[model samples]
Target: MGIITAGKYEGQHPIHPKARQILLDAFDQGWADPTQISSQGRQAQALLDQARESIAKSLGLKVDEIELWGEPELISPIAIWGAPGFGVSPFIYGATERSEIIGMRGKSKQFFEISVDIDGAIDLELLTQTLQPNSIVAIQSANIETGVIQNIKAIAKAVVAQNAHLHIDATASGARFVKPSYWSTLHFDARSWNGPSGVGVFALKNGARWSNPLPHTRPTRAPNSFSIPLALAAASALEHWIADEAANSTRLKSLIERVRNHVKQTISDVDIAGNAESTLPNIISLSFLNVSSEQLVAELEIEGFSVASGSACVASALEPSHVLKAMGLLTHGNMRINLNHDVQDGEITKLLALLPGIISKLREN
Candidate 1:
């Protein structure tokens, strides 16, 4: 099949050619333990430090504040509830947050979800009312499914006014958006920006009032010894993403609007989710009137175009998307399209050309 499914999900991008070369070149030293004092270990330590410094520079953070790990899902809980010495405080998140954030309910001291407007933005008024001193407020820079960017600066200000901490998940935003200066903590996945998988970075601002929640006998608090080559590759990929950010954003925004406008004009009983004015240029979530998301996905696949029926993070789930539900949008027949950073204009045009006929056929039957 001549398939084009770029932006299928996070880390789904084929490793950048430059990142692959970096990984290969560092393969030997990457295997050595950076903590050991041996010569080889010292070389590995140099590589690791370089990688960390590169990432820190990219995020505008100090080197010591960065922690490298594999899982993006685990970062939220650890940052929100695991900090040692910090007393359990209320955990608040937007209703449109990833399931992982919403799932923190049982694990937190007291978890609450703030409502989102139709555009999938956190209701700032409700959030203000819900804040408690020492509370941990988790908000993503951008919604993975809807691509709605949050007002993190405002949110962080409110959280701080209440003497609470804010954790911003920049995984979906990657290098596309800058972190708010007032954010207490932030995290991003390497794979989100066309880097290799199996690496993620978490950053805690100095004086952020967080400690490792996990019982620690080890000198280091990070859970895993990540692959040094992977870290280097990730940093390299991030550099490239940042360099291309402006052009990519402009091109992708134009292409996304093309599809959005075409679908609205040609299709029946359709609703486009998220506020276009405040969303990432890459992702769009659409709902159909009488189509089964599964069947529509299958049909699209047969046509050599791969699309997601719901959130890529929870594609295996049978229930409707929590993001759409929170926004009071139709949850059934939902499809999320994420345009790849390198996607061509022709690819988008091709998809738009096919959608009307495919959707009409599906609805008629």
Candidate 2:
């Protein structure tokens, strides 16, 4: 199939021969709410347990620390706003995240944005200055569009000194550079890890407290309706994918190296974002001197290559990526290339060979 634009299966489906049967078996047992504990629920619960255990083992965490949720956004809000007994807090970071944070603006008195350096990393000095009692600091482990990795270890320490909590959105960092154990220790009261677009895992460190951020009658904390099949698939994908990552990351790093070297050598005035050594191996964000990112993405797609401008999650929006803008870089001409394993080396070499010509041709237009 075409290069996967989705999760761990990026460029290829992660459904190995054995895993495919497991997934189908999960579906065959079919739609039963895992929470019910009936006969059907028992079957569903078994699947859920297997999924939870698999995901936990992959990340080096115990099963109970991980909680399943249907909504990806629910984890963040719940972690930030849930009652202490349930692991919620009133702390809010000054900088922004997504729809959930925006929705809470009117409800929070403690909201604040942490400043970033020119490279889009949180200014450690500024972050240090912002700490307060009972605060919860929200920071993404890696900036989505720029691939800028945050020093969560440092940030966590700073949060602790202030007697506060740390909430890391590891959507982009999970199964990449930050291992599951790193997250278990680094994440303070709560942290949200995105396993796939549809499945979200919110981990509450054993004793962290939170307040309920959202309203519901039963206080049903889980989101995304708890699908047994999707959870099983997601867990299966993560376990197998993590096992495959060491080799894959090495391969992906080589591909990105080619891009970095090719661009530096052939494309004058192109700005590559992030700390090259620390950036995510699979992603590179580059901006040509005078070209629009939209035009470049369209041109490349017409040439039978798929790439994204900024984060894939926000590509459809017209606004310049919050990530690039925050870094004080031009948002107009940025293109983020996220490499997938299915992408052949020949394709990357061809694209690299063709890029200079494409840029020159686009420049003339």
In TM-score terms, which candidate is top? 1
lDDT, residue 56, candidate 1:
86
The 0-to-1 C-alpha lDDT of every candidate, in the order given, reads 0.79, 0.63
lDDT of 1 by residue, 304-332 (tens): 87777664333676677788888998888
Best by lDDT: 1
The TM-score obtained by model 1 is 0.93
Question: Over the stretch 1-365, how does candidate 2's per-residue lDDT look in tens digits?
Answer: 24423322132223444455666887887757777768989877877788888877776666777776665556666676653422234455535354454455456655667767666667888788767766667777775566777777777778777767666776666655353222222221101122334566777666665434566667544444755676776687676666666557788788888889989999988878876776887777887877766677777777777666763333676566666676777677677776654557777887788788888887888
Q: Least accurate stretch of 10 residues (summed lDDT) in model 2?
A: 185-194
Clashes of 1: 3
Candidate 2 lands at a TM-score of 0.85
